[model samples]
Target: MGWLWDNAVTLATIVMAAAAVAALVYAHLSITENRAAERRANANELWRERS
Candidate 1:
């Protein structure tokens, strides 16, 4: 791992940045899915109540 030793700090920073971006993407997608589920649930309840 000569390359890693040569650029340890930069490599670590890059890895951390990638992890941060991934986490943000995951969180955004999870929130979107949760909101969609909530909407579906509400719609079902409304239809059930009407019938």
Candidate 2:
């Protein structure tokens, strides 16, 4: 469509922004998961030492 062609750049920019946001969200979730796993490991180590 003529309107879509005229706004192609705008559409592309929006798509890129959305993708960047998604990447940031994924990275944050991964960091949180890693921290949780590290905490669990640390607790297990402490338990073993105590026992």
lDDT per prediction?
Answer: 0.98, 1.00
Q: Identify the candidate with maximal lDDT.
A: 2
* Alpha carbon deviation, residue 15, candidate 1 (Å): 0.2
Specify the highest-TM-score model's number.
2
User: Relative to the unseen true structure, what is the Cα RMSD of model 1?
Assistant: 0.8
Candidate 2: list runs displaced more than 4 Å: none
In terms of lDDT, model 1 sits at 0.98
Off by over 4 Å in 1: none
lDDT, residue 5, model 2? 100
lDDT of 2 by residue, 1-51 (tens): 999999999999999999999999999999999999999999999999999
Q: Estimate each model's TM-score.
A: 0.94, 0.95
Q: Lowest lDDT 10-mer window, candidate 1?
A: 1-10
Candidate 1 TM-score, C-alpha based:
0.94
